[model samples]
Target: MNSASDAVKEIVIEIVNSTPFWTAFSACFIAYLNRNKGKKLTAEKDGVKFSLENMNHHEMTEALEDAKKIMVSDNGKKPT
Candidate 1:
């Protein structure tokens, strides 16, 4: 069990070591988006619920940038 744990750790180490920053970032972002789905920016405004699907492409892109900015600022760390 200890050796298995060590092996797993080694594999993780290799993966993290070999992965480029952008690739890791993209993977994490995709996973986050997948997990979030309908939860992303869903809000009740007035009597209407707003979501990313309601936004235009430019607005959606800006919203994503805003979300990334908030995340990085709050955590003091870049995604992935």
Candidate 2:
């Protein structure tokens, strides 16, 4: 019984240490972490909430330009 248990333990350890298992596990873990890292920026104005990530490139550029104009109009205060 002792020898049988030891063999089983070794087999389990070997399986856990295998390259394929590690590769699959790493891929899944990285995907999970990236999924959570992709949280969109949110803003609330006039009691309306919206996500910045939903904007297209043109819209993003326009918004950034508007922000720069605002900053420039505020006595040439450079953004930190």
Candidate 3:
């Protein structure tokens, strides 16, 4: 048998654990959406500008892994 305090403590712990899940999800969702918004805003405010298309394969892979680390770091997770 647990006291009322114990139940409340469990609920609080659960909420705390769940918070980062929601926060990371929302952050990722918002970041994805912002990319589209950024493109649109850039096109509207700035005229067509040339962008690089080609990237070194090795460098590109490294850059991607770096980005993954940043995105996953907040969740206390690491990239494989």
lDDT of 1 by residue, 1-80 (tens): 57988999998766644435335444554455456554343433344444543455444443443222222212233433
Relative to the true structure, candidate 3 reaches a TM of: 0.26
Model 1 lDDT at residue 41? 39
Ranking by lDDT: 2, 1, 3
1: Cα error in model 1, Å: 10
Candidate 2: deviation at residue 11, Å? 1.4
Instruction: Give the lDDT of residue 2 in candidate 1.
Output: 75
Q: How does each model score on TM-score?
A: 0.30, 0.37, 0.26
Q: Any runs in candidate 2 off by more than 4 Å, and if so which? A: 1-4, 38-80
lDDT of the structure predicted as candidate 1: 0.45
- Assess the local accuracy of residue 24 in candidate 1 as a C-alpha lDDT between 0 and 100: 47
Q: Rate the local accuracy (lDDT) of all candidates.
A: 0.45, 0.45, 0.37
What lDDT tens digits, residue by residue, belong to model 2 across residues 16-64? 6565554554454344434545443443434444454445544433343
Better of 1 and 3 by lDDT: 1
Candidate 1 regions exceeding 4 Å error are: 20-22, 26-80
Identify the runs in model 3 with alpha carbons over 4 angstroms from their true place.
Answer: 19-80
lDDT by residue for model 3 over 1-80, one digit each (tens)? 99999999998767645645445544444454344333211111122232212323343233333121222212222322
